[model samples]
Target: MLTRRTALLGATLALPAQAQERFPSRPVTLIVPGAPGGGGDFTARLLAEGLAGPLGQSVPVENRTGGSGNVAASFVARAAPDGYTLLLAYSGTHVANPALFRELAWHPIRSFAPVALLLTAPHVLVIRPDLPARDMAELAAYIRRNPGRVTYASSGVASIQHLGGAMLAQALGTEMVHVPYRGAGPAMSDIIAGRVDMIITTPPAVMGQIQTGAVRAIVQTGRARHPMLPNLPTTAEAGLPGFELEAWFGIYAPAGTPREAVLRLSRDIQGVTETAEFRRKAQEAGTYVTFLGPEELAAFTATELTRWSGIIQGLGIRLD
Candidate 1:
């Protein structure tokens, strides 16, 4: 026989314990900041499938695409920090957007808790099949000779592809007109059709074209050569030292999410990436699985923000 006051006190005392124990009692949602079947979406689904067993809950991926991931980033920023709502953050959203946009609705660093870094995929230098240049050296020389006449296409203004193109131009000390497109599909289509001179984009985006002889692969933009394209040299070996660049992906929960949950989710994600099946699948998906836990991911994000901000500022890129 307990009095009402006594019962209320007992319930209040148990609330914190209940909250602590109720983590992941239901399914978790991993928000992808891109359309379905895209890299982000593919990574999200892969992690979700692997995370369910360890987290003891169903992890589902939801695509919330628009505004270069702003819509999804904002939604995750405002979501309850119960560890249920997470974001599949990438270079464009977390690292590049802060510098590209004059004012973003949500601060990438402040609005989220870094969970883990999932993978990194390097870009490959490609040119039209009939382009006079045969390799990166020849391409650089050709651009030097052609000067402003040579053109490069990017997915859009301020995109990673654009930044890569800019960096390449800066490295070669050449002037090539930047042609922005709505998306990679259109840009790659134009590249295949010889509407653009060249494009430095991810292999997955143009691997089909390369295989079909629609475009020629010249070099890869990574410290080391990609295993899939062992014959191709890296940018450093291709005569552009210090020209390495790769797009990375990570996971994050909204700021103020439980510290315990963040650590738990980070550990689970690391475990997911360590599995043999996951590694093989990641290789198949054209990305190498690299796991960085919360602390490492946070530091990595900070460094990336700084690096890309410097690059964007140097390039004088701004989107309001």
Candidate 2:
């Protein structure tokens, strides 16, 4: 009787292992926590396309936009703990939203499992071409000279763009009133029309305008220059040191997922991101591919949350 019981227990444990080994038995759904045609949507779609062949499953992306990405994040937290449902979590969804929303249904670290880091994009300090300030130094001087007269736009309050702009102001010791918009597209439009004095926007959103000379990209908020915009100087290089902030996106699965399943998914995503096609697409989107493994990705998420919390508190921003 004892030997038979031992055999049954071993079989039960081995069954889970075997199931994990053969991951993605069916179609995988990648959830994008933003509207279609935006960075999160585009990135999720590309990841789905890039992961299909390697993972031996059809990866379909679904957009769920609301509450500044909290809606989709909450949905993912309640999803089945299988590898089929995955989340494309960006800075706003994973880090800032938790602090910004008073009643966020899911905890970023506790409610979901981190798979891998996808991409990191630096925000560009952009202004209308007609603005007199030509570079960061000039912009800083102008803002100090005309405090409260200039307004900066961001996609939303507590967003990376918002924190980036606030951090810049704190470092430069100047005051530039913030104007929050529903999204980056509308904010960029207002900046182009001269409705907003300047904006801290993503490179992908404002790259076309910068190329056309409609908006002047004075500097990028990163530690080093991006390959796509090598000529553009970093914010630290321009004047303010320690002013490096980049928007990052990663993949997550619902918590309590099988450990082996999470490892398998992470390996697959790392492989897909390192592929030539994925790299090319990422570069074209004005971002660099940096896939962090499980432990590193979790640590990075914690750091990002802390960084944004400080900025939000300092700026006295509250979405609630």
Candidate 3:
């Protein structure tokens, strides 16, 4: 029974199985669900550079825009369960889209497995310099006086920008019109021209406008102030309690990906986030470097989903 031939046969059979355990035997692709030169694209590329050395494989970023980021989400959700194909998921696509669209091709929780959270930044509230509002209180009075005549611009109908504006109006017991534009650039342009009264958007999108005096930043929509905008007060500090909105970015793999591979990637990503160079770059981009492993990321996303769904339902705003 212990013959040399039997031993050789057993060893031969295990060769393929052992070979399959080595992940990253090939290059990895990180898919971005936004256009090039956008914030998401820039962050993805920065992460990709840091990940390549540690992963021992090139991590190329691929952008697939359109359909409100569904094009990229659907593609990643249907890709092979191996770690080779991954998604650079943003809060908008994963958190807001669930409530924005009545039907989605890919499910945030079911279609993909969380790998790691990259960073987080609270949205900034910007208004035209000519607006009489110096802060949220004055803005509320201005809105109450003008009613629906006070309009706010947003990147899209059900975007975070739009939802933030709605929340602000509800908190102030006032009403304001929403002007939906194709993108934040156009929305910012209109606001700078004083065509729109106000806008709520991510920090990076409004930093230039705020610095150049094109728009006045009344408050940041986070519990605490960010280092990038230390002079700006938080909503609670501005006397508007219970107003918080933080944007996050993370990595995800198609569902059913190997557990070991997911864990390995998470650890590798965390290493990159902790580097000094990465932190400096993220801070300069107006985002704080935040890292969450797989389980933590999943739980955080679940809580966000529940919170956003309630807000969306109460507002009765649904987009196809």
Candidate 4:
């Protein structure tokens, strides 16, 4: 009886080893750090679809919204270092959060191993139609001419839109008051009413406003103009060299995840991003593909983390 009981315990312990050898013997879960219907959620679902076939398993998306994404980041950080569990992270997770969340438990570099950097979404430089500015030069002139009177609206404090405004001010060698709204809706409404001088936010956030002629999209900070905003010139084309503000999207797994699994996932994800269908869908979704492998993602994140940390500090923007 003793021998039989000992053999049963040994078999139980070997089960996990056998499963680990197979890598993903079951479905994988991709956790998004935002509510459903958000940009991150949309990208996560799209990526999940592309991954399922290649992974030989279903990749389900799970929304873990709250705590300004720390909730999801910490959850993934604590998850087993296996390929089965992954994170679909936003640029703010590293670039903005580190400076804001002083007590952030998960270090972007230490807590997770980057699988791939998938896309970069650009922001639009929009202003109320009543403003005399119609282009980057004109806008800069208007902003400079107005001095501290010009105002920029954002979804909230420390949001990408807010940072973009600050960057714009810095690039133009001027200052614009930051007006934070509870969300983008209020910001849009006020901007339409000419209550705010400008707003730098995602293309989607201002696409309709631009179309309806409520807001003038003078320039967009993308390599190429968005299909929906063909007339909008990119920063480079607008004669604003090196003045680009974009949100990056990437995938990560818990640190200590097997290198083999990381490489495998990265290669497959690269393949996914390269597909014609994926490209079409991603562009339509306002996410421009810019794939980077594990090492590249790690290095890029580190550089961005440093740059944004200083920028945040200089701006004196802090959030809980």
Which model is ahead, 3 or 4, in terms of TM-score?
3
Q: What is the C-alpha lDDT profile of model 4 across 95-118, one tens digit per residue? A: 688898768879999999999998
lDDT of 4 at 83: 84
Error of 3 at 61 (Å): 2.9
lDDT of 3 by residue, 175-283 (tens): 8898976556677888899999898887767787788898999999888888888898999998888888887889999999999899999999999999999998888
All candidates: CA RMSD in angstroms? 3.2, 4.1, 3.3, 4.2
- Scanning candidate 3 in windows of ten residues, the lowest lDDT window is 34-43
Can you give the TM-score per candidate against the true fold? 0.86, 0.85, 0.85, 0.77
lDDT of 2 at 48: 89
Candidate 2 per-residue lDDT, tens place, 246-284, comes to: 788899999988878789889989999989999998887
Clashes of each: 0, 0, 0, 0
All candidates' lDDT scores? 0.83, 0.82, 0.85, 0.82
Question: Model 1 off-target regions past 4 Å?
Answer: 1-21, 36-38, 181-186, 193-195, 212-214
Pick by TM-score: which candidate is best?
1
